[model samples]
Target: MAAGGSYGAALTDLGERLVGDVITPGDADYDEARKIFNTMIDRRPAAIAQCETAPDVAHAIRFARDHVLPLAVRGGGHSVAGMSLVDGGLVIDLRRMDAVTVDPGARTATVGGGAIMSGLDRATQPYGLATTGGRVSTTGVGGFVLGGGAGFLDRAFGLACDNLLSVDLVTAQGDQLHVDEKEHPELFWALHGGGGNFGVATAFTLRLHPLTTMTAMLLLWRPEAGPAVARAYRDFFESAPGQVGGGLLYLTGPPEEFVPDDMVDTLVCAVLLTYTGHEERARAITAPLLRLGHDAEMITELPYADLQCMLDDPPGYRNYWSAEYLDSFPDQAVDRFCARASDMVVPSPSQHVLFPQGAAVTEGPSDYPLPWRGAAWIVHPFGLWDDPADDARVRQWAHDTRADVRPWSRGAVYLNFIGREGRDRVIEGFGAENYHRLAGVKALYDPDNVFRLNHNIEPRIEPRPAGR
Candidate 1:
């Protein structure tokens, strides 16, 4: 659809002078360029410019603006809602710019937009250093950081944005600028948790911490013990130390080498715990969790990088994740969760995960654009399936689960997990005050709203009504 005329001519002219690949629909790699992490989403972008430099990104932006084409920025192409590709639009793929520079003395690393969690971790692990990142290794640092990343180290360090030292971004006007606490502080604040609505981030400098070995474990309990397991997990997390980070989930056993044949398709509740501390100390701290009436306890000490990738799910798997922040996990809610866990289809492997929040994540809501601060827990209903025919069933199940838990939630959702729900949901994600502020920042840097993908925040030329 976007293969000819002035748009194609402009791309061709730029490609001749650029260092990266400019692929059109007719190209052999077009299919791969358009493919994102979720196989359920099949999008065909008109053109995908794999950028190698910031100037190339700026050029792509200018070309898109000149052609009046919808633009999607792809950094690892892992958006749950598949916002990284727009049919017949220009896709600026940053995956080619995967450069990383580490400042060991300063404990900071500057990563290119295309860098994935695995790449970053590999680079930093040699120095026994790490930064806040997503749990999965394939997750792109750009999207994860911009959306307020949470991972194993979050409780010890903070959210990914909290550790961000600076970022290089290309604006709608084809201008490149460095943003941080000192320069363009407002834009920097918005970039932290404002999703990808501000500008196209070219690179990020993140603060890292020394992390050597950590104790990580997967404790599995039968479905019948869901209630007891949930209660114990809730109580343990309520008073857990800042060094401890874990989440509870109900899932069907994976067909792995370690899983018994009988348990392969059985419903089970699992607790994933990771303690970033000395081996002995971590074992002592998590001893109670290992003893929590589980059918199995698979605990071990491993490198931090290994622990980070332990939960990596394969790409192309159909998934729908919905989340809500809870003030507290009430007894009734626990009962409901247990009951729901027992009713799950044994072979489907759908899950309800509750991640505890406090300390690093419970700071003032004003500290970042992300709302839902101080919420005790984040409940995520994750649906996974491979059958195209069962798509509706999986999606509806997640939706219903989230709806059922809404009454006890903080009425806010995590941007990364939200789908194409609507602008209203986007507003609710960041709260009124924060959303308006983010909109103002968006207007100042990207007046035309060039970066409208992700959980978009509309540019505000004037002040909005209170509680908008």
Candidate 2:
């Protein structure tokens, strides 16, 4: 079987025996298969094999290794960088393998790598159980967990990684390995936040918590009150209990029913709050924020699943996002945020989000390779528009806003939010020691580096060189 070419005969042989769809560049669904959530990234892979089982992933990994082809792994395909696809490589797409098995008696859930937040939430909601997941329902469980996951429940349960119990992965050598704190411990630790450098994770057994009712709301204020609102939000988050988690977003008014017709499209400061405690106590916990002067209030008691989808953005909308971690949201930082926020030029609704950091995130730096544990806020500047022509404007806006606030940042960026930058940013995503450690583990599990498409950490034979 010839396996040396881009579209090798070996791949064809493997696809024939596989149970999933094999998408080639000429296929009718290829365009949709290659499409990602971020409109800014458009790449064409040589082929995309949507895996249906762990063995299917193993087959894809073996094919990429034998063919010496660049490989990308797609879970939810929501990466801002679109690392899920490569220009001339094989993409082991996992979107079709989204299955969730809940062990409610054990308080655990074993989820397929391709499962999205909504799928997992729906499966676990019947038991009133959930783990830390992305705020948006569409985010994938695989990439989000492998990178450090933050969501409305993070403050209470810690990151998604903290709840991870075990993972089923297909290594570069085509052998399956089950990793956990007790077995293959180092590899497990690296997988916590090391991105997709180690292997293709097929499924994860995660610890779940009982999550019943919670309070979720969006509080809006005029632009003039930005400074005061920032101050109030900063103070409130400083001492808020772990049960409370959310962010303050500086955004243009939405042209929806929630806002009055006259205020539509006007700039405003919106505090998005979610408290995962008893419904009655949630009010008291968020009292400081709710009291801040605002133009409108949309607070309500909702189930955890409903709250998860409350902020879902349309799938195909154009989006450009840049994120950073701040040591503190001091008055100076707030001033800078407000200054750049005031200059948002996109007529569409763009936003600057300030998410609180700490609580479980600060337990230990060694727990996960993810930096920014001590950060006071995780700032994300999201530029949204509906037209391809406006793509340049939104991209530039996200970049400029990120640059404007760079000085106040902690020199740390969220791996999930990073785009197609090179190795330097990848190394920076995991601090030096963690990066080196992850590299060594990557070498053991995937020496050929078949999973080179993400924020890659090159597999190393020995420890990383001194300075690198």
lDDT of 1 by residue, 74-157 (tens): 997888888999988889999988888999999999999999998999899889898888888898999999988888788888
Total clashing residue pairs per candidate? 0, 0
* Model 2 steric clash pairs: none
TM-score for each model: 0.95, 0.94
RMSD of 1: 2.9
Tens digits of per-residue lDDT for model 2 on 175-243?
A: 899999898999989988887888888999999999877888788887778888998989988888888
Most TM-score-accurate candidate: 1
- Tell me the lDDT of model 2 at 320: 74
Candidate 2 lDDT at 135 equals: 84
RMSD of each: 2.9, 3.1
